[model samples]
Target: MTFTRQGCLLVIAVALASPVLAEGPDPVRGAELFPIRCVECHVITDGAEKKIGPSLKGLIGRTSGTLEGYDYSDAMKTAGIVWSEQTLKTYLVAPRKMVPGTKMNFNGLKRPGEVEDVVAYLLEAGT
Candidate 1:
């Protein structure tokens, strides 16, 4: 292929700008999955109320087990994790694997994509 420099730059720009080529976590899908996978145990709303799990509001920057008025397992309370996208991704894959002896009874999301989606949903919704 004979290409001018400008043509090459344009092609590169287009590739960079393509959503299919640069896909990210989908919060919409996360929102859908959250009710099915998480709502029974967790609530993302603003409150200190206890469900099966603690409210996840403002989760991104918060440290693990720091939410007031919730009883966390000793493992979670002492783990000292800072919640971020990467940290959530790791934790959501396997809660027990990441934080051994956590009281959360659910196994895990079991899919990397779903974990990403849930993290995205929590990041957006918890804010």
Candidate 2:
């Protein structure tokens, strides 16, 4: 029944790391999940790339369709969309309804948490 420096250090480390390691999505985790869940259509990259959907590179803080050489839905371009954390979060929850007429064919993500994680991945990785 005593205190030890090693135990104290271990407890402090755990406490500090717990918040960072919490259930929230890590961008790395998002990257790994992207291909399986998302890469089928979207190409999230910096280069001039086009997929079944649009390239999502530089997505965070970027205006929709600003990327050249990609054909975007009239709704997406004219919607004046901006991909920020808030906007992406809302959009990812429901793609079709968010941008009506958007060419993206995927149904809305079923899990709010998964959407959040994917957004985190896209934002962090797309850069």
Candidate 3:
């Protein structure tokens, strides 16, 4: 079959994307994903007061229920988790399962790449 110019461009685009697809989630994509997925309820600004949720600045090494002023759910306040890359990756995959009764209502990220990307983004942004 002969390819039209548009079709050829589409093929080239897909080809360029293949490596990124294989290499796992990009932080740039993670940054893109954050606003769409988490920004409604969370913010990443440093020293900012809590919005619907606590600011995610310095989130990486933080204790789960210890965001100072933000009121945490009983279950979360008592669970005693320390946020690490691995823990964040797993928690992002299933929030309710990881911390049942947490106040946040997110359904959890469905894809591994999405989780990875978000975790990667948070690592940078949280700092």
Candidate 4:
């Protein structure tokens, strides 16, 4: 089919902007993934409780290592990060790399889209 340059650009822009082409984080998928990937160490329920890791009940907007009652690694405490969607996405990719001395043992989520999904779940459930 013949197409003008402007028409091709418009088509490309529309494709790029389409929701089907740019699906965002899915909380339901995130919820399913959370149990598989993060439930072992973290809890998202209400309380200052300790599991293998700290309670993630109020994760969004919370400063790293500041959750009461959970003892954080010196590195985490000193990193001084405020948890947010963007930061969570970065940190979830490589926990140790993000905070070199963090006590979290899991290597970090490596699967495509898993980090975003899990972060979405945490934001939804932890809040």
Candidate 5:
């Protein structure tokens, strides 16, 4: 099939726009997973009491272990991480592997989808 100029342009435009149109991770699924997977250890609310882990409020822009009043392991405090979605995904895959000697005792969310969903939930909840 021969491509017309307008057809090529339209295809290019759609290709470029597809990513923006694509749905982001499902926060609903993340919400479902959070209580079962994270609430016992982490809380997403701001000003909430720190439980086994620090409150995750405003977590995306914050550096790891910088939250006030939460006692972080020295390794986590020194990891110098900025919590972006990508960084959080990596960390959730294997917390100890990412930050050796860290005190987050839970092994990790082994499934990528769960990690993604959790990240989505945390990001939304923190906001």
Candidate 6:
């Protein structure tokens, strides 16, 4: 086998880029799963304030710990996280591990499909 400088650079670039992969939820699936599991406590409407939990509008690109008027615990504040579809899915799967000592009481979702569905629902809701 022979390698050129350009080939080596391309391989290195691919190796470095492997850590960032794209993953987003299916909106249809999320819509179905959301009302069944999440709507009891949360709302996703724009301009809507805190429900039993804070409104989740515009969560895809929002900063993790900066929502106004909701009382967040120190655990979530200090997690050094940002909320994206990927982060939401990860947190929804295991909140305790993702942000220890936060007060969300629901058992973390165990199914990938359900998590995707919920995320999709959150992404498309109230818009």
Clash pairs detected, candidate 5: none
Better of 3 and 6 by TM-score: 3
Candidate with top lDDT is 1
Residue 55 lDDT in candidate 1? 91
Better of 1 and 4 by TM-score: 4
Error of 4 at 121 (Å): 1.2
lDDT order, best first, reads 1, 4, 3, 5, 2, 6
| Residue 40, candidate 4: alpha-carbon lDDT | 88
Residues 47-69, candidate 5, lDDT per residue (tens digit)?
Answer: 95789999988898899999999
lDDT of 3: 0.86
Q: Model 4, residue 25: what's the lDDT?
A: 74
- Looking at model 4, report the run of 10 residues with the lowest lDDT sum: 15-24
RMSD of each: 5.9, 7.6, 6.9, 4.8, 6.6, 8.0
- Candidate 1 residue lDDT tens string, 86-110: 8998888899999999999989888
On residues 1-127, what C-alpha lDDT tens digit does candidate 3 reach at each position?
8999999998888768776556786788999999999999899987757778888988988988888888888988998889988999878888999998888898999864788888889888887
Better of 2 and 4 by lDDT: 4
lDDT of 3 at 49: 73
Clashing pairs in 3: none
The residue pairs in collision within model 1 are none
Per-candidate clashes, comma-separated:
0, 0, 0, 0, 0, 2
lDDT of 6: 0.74
Global lDDT of each candidate = 0.88, 0.78, 0.86, 0.87, 0.85, 0.74
Off by over 4 Å in 6: 1-25
Indicate whether candidate 2 or candidate 3 has the larger TM-score: 3
lDDT per residue for candidate 2 within 22-113, as digits (tens), equals 56766766777789878998887668878887788788878876778888888888888888888887887788888898987878767535
